[model samples]
Target: MRFAIISVTKEGQKLASDMELVLRNDPTVIKVDLFHKNVKDTVSNLFNDYDCWVAIMATGIMVRIICPIIKSKLKDPAVLVVAENKKHVISLLSGHMGGGNKFSIKIAGVIGAVPVITTATDLNGKMGIDALANQYWFDVKQPQLIKAVNQLIAENGKVDLHLPSRFRFLENHPLVTRSYCIHIWEKSFIRASLPGKEFENELDLYPKRIVAGLGSKKGVAGEQVFFAIRSALQHLHLPLERLDALATVDLKKDEEGIIDAASKSDLPLEIVTLNEISDFKHVDCTPSKLVQREFGVQGVSEPVSLIRAGESSRLILKKTAYNGVTVAIAVSTN
Candidate 1:
């Protein structure tokens, strides 16, 4: 992840340089830039450019400069404040979703300082939804509700975890104390159940499980394609959040409907040409005579899904027809 280190003093500059050198050698540390002047104005402008910010200055200064530019915790970059003496590294904002807490600890270890994390969930030794999402590569739907769900854990209120039989071991997480219920997987629900004391308050987490292959008609509206995909997933008892990406033949890479649906859902779009998909044709597939005559391929959805899913994948849902669209689903092997 890219990090921006803003130093405001001579001592802070020296420490920032030292930390930059140490982080440069770490494979996980992608890019690190040090800024020494015009911090109040320049730092906020770099908010969207960097993944995290390490400010070698007073916490109050960081707070004042960051508060106005502060956005949703889900989208903001991790903010950490460091003392010039290298004695304390405090997570100032976006402690979980922004990876501030973990970044703080690692930076502290390198600088010989104490990592001070103020998030209640970390301090109390409970896992927040953001932390859980990061661990499993799950998307946190409705991030606004995360605080309400975490508040339940903080108040010692009941927070139950309902896992599918395959994931029942997750019930052992520290936050799941009073409630541990193994559930059947053949249901429409996500199976990632984090319910608060009041049933209305809940945290919605979804795994990046399925790849959706789409074939849409020319100039088709995204709403139609998106609706078809959601309906297919619903019919198969799969949560839409489990959709990791959208796959299609290269011809449809610029298809308005496919591109719009992927963009709206924040999913990566993977496309493959007929040549790349031809290699997978021998790998058990349903043939479409009409599609073969028109597109020079037996199938678009199924083969594209397999290609995007890599070698260790299975075709879970064969091509399903929808108005002006064809859809298929593939899952990676466990």
Candidate 2:
């Protein structure tokens, strides 16, 4: 996450320059611009080109001007307010859910101030590292096994790459041709990786970021389902390897044959509830009157998958046995 930190300070006080050294530890705070006592640039410029804004200032009035500026933008970056005294840090808005929240906490932690983390999920430490990894365009080698996430907190803890952190380290340089974490996966996104022994057959998960959804009627042909999935993805202009996991309604328990297929393919199954499926659907589609009333069309047809672009969905079943089915495959909706 790129940031433009504005420190409202007085002339000849050298607070802004002194503050720069304090914030430099956070790499996510890619850049910081100082606004001395006199600069008239509105805080809106922070949203003009950056992912978020960090305000390290003293007066509530200074913080007030920034609020309206952020209110005007449709795509708002995370906003954070802290005191120059390094005494307190408060996430007035967009703490975690917003793009700027995590950075705000880091800045607070570094300046020797308590991070006023208001996000309930974060305060409890139940925050999803996978989600964070995804947001930063980074990958997790062992997501489930990640004991704790090592975040680069900027305030007091120096943002040192070698610092003991739970998050795997990353450096900005040439695009990682070989597997690397934290990046937006474009359709033209190409990557290189040594074949995981598990995927020795095709090594399909070279750059995994997609999730697949399956929708099969009582008995649709597998060939039709596969072709339908393929054709649907091609129609959507998505790639095959981006698949991260397989999704379906809980109707298909662990006994569900499709579950076994995903296991064979090394894709984990993410069985969602009827409500969760509906929340992700792109449109209010009705698959069948009976099923629609019971579950959203996405649960019935599996169409809500949208992790990122350049990814797709597939149904794994016996190609020989035909089962009438429809599948929706795509990336997570971050």
Candidate 3:
């Protein structure tokens, strides 16, 4: 997550610089840019580039500049406004989904300022559905359900939470143990669980635990590669949303088909060198003689997946060929 800090006054600029240094300690923040002039144009250019915007300017000025470009809570970047003297930190836009409300408090803690969070969910001290989804890297399948779930929480109502048995931390978490929530499984549902009768407010979170390795001919079509990967995942009973990333041999670094497939899935493509693939001793999958002769490695997908994952990684699906593409799936040890 990148943060863009915009300031006009000397005090605000100094505060912005100090905040940038303070936020650099967080591993999640990759970059932070400071914009001292051309506030509107700079924000306009950087709106889509950064994850959040920290404007050390008046709230009215922020509103006039940001309102015209504001799309929605889901699509917009988190916007925060700080006073020149750093007395107040205000979440001006994208409170829940964009993480503005939560980040405002973080900035306030560093600057010894009051965080003004106006969101109803935060006001009621109820966990927002979008915040929960963001915490787990879970893509909201049905975004409309977020409103229903948040509304239920805000109304002092209970909603059932379903998670894998292994996630005992979340099951016993302070946030999850609140009176407005209950834990339930697919197989167990008591009559009193839905005391509010809010059947439409369930939130489902899926874990992205699968890493897919891809290999394909140079000129193969993207659709074919995608079809092959999707088919393999379907055969293995793995949801596409659970795919964490895509791995491929470095030789396919410029391959259009594999790139297209990964782009369509919105997964990061981890390219491995030939030496890494050939020397991978963790995985023992079948090797192809033709591939070995041409690519300097007996196999591409399995070794690449194993390299991306550590030595303890487990191969969930062996290399499966479809048309001119090959894909393999692995579960990371961690």
Which one wins on lDDT? Answer: 1
lDDT of 2 by residue, 1-334 (tens): 3455666555223544665776554322334665544423656444555555566665475466665666522245666667767777677654533544556556666666777766444544433333234333333444322222223121111111121121122333222111133333333322222223332211111133555556665444445555555554453334343356666666754434565556554557666666665665442232456566655443444443342222332221111112455555443322
Model 1, 64-90: lDDT tens digits are 998999878878889999999999999
Give the alpha carbon lDDT tens digit for every residue of 1-334 in model 3: 5689999898889998899888776534546788896998988877977778999999998999987898877778999999888799999988877888878988899899999999777787767777765544444656767777777777877666664434434545556455234544553212112334454544455553568888888899889988988887875544565577889988888899888988998889998999887777752466889888897787988788777865577566777788998887776534
**Against the true structure, whose TM-score is highest?**
3
TM-score of each: 0.59, 0.37, 0.60
When summed lDDT is taken over every stretch of 10 residues in candidate 1, the lowest stretch is 175-184
With a 3 Å backbone cut-off (N, CA, C), the pairs that clash in candidate 3 are none
Model 1 vs truth, CA RMSD: 14.1
Cα lDDT, all candidates: 0.76, 0.45, 0.75
Q: After superposition, how far is residue 129 of candidate 1 from its true place, in Å?
A: 1.7
C-alpha lDDT of candidate 1 relative to the true structure? 0.76
After superposing candidate 2 on the true structure, give the runs of residues whose Cα lies further than 4 Å from its correct spot: 11-13, 22-27, 38-40, 71-74, 128-334
TM-score of model number 3: 0.60
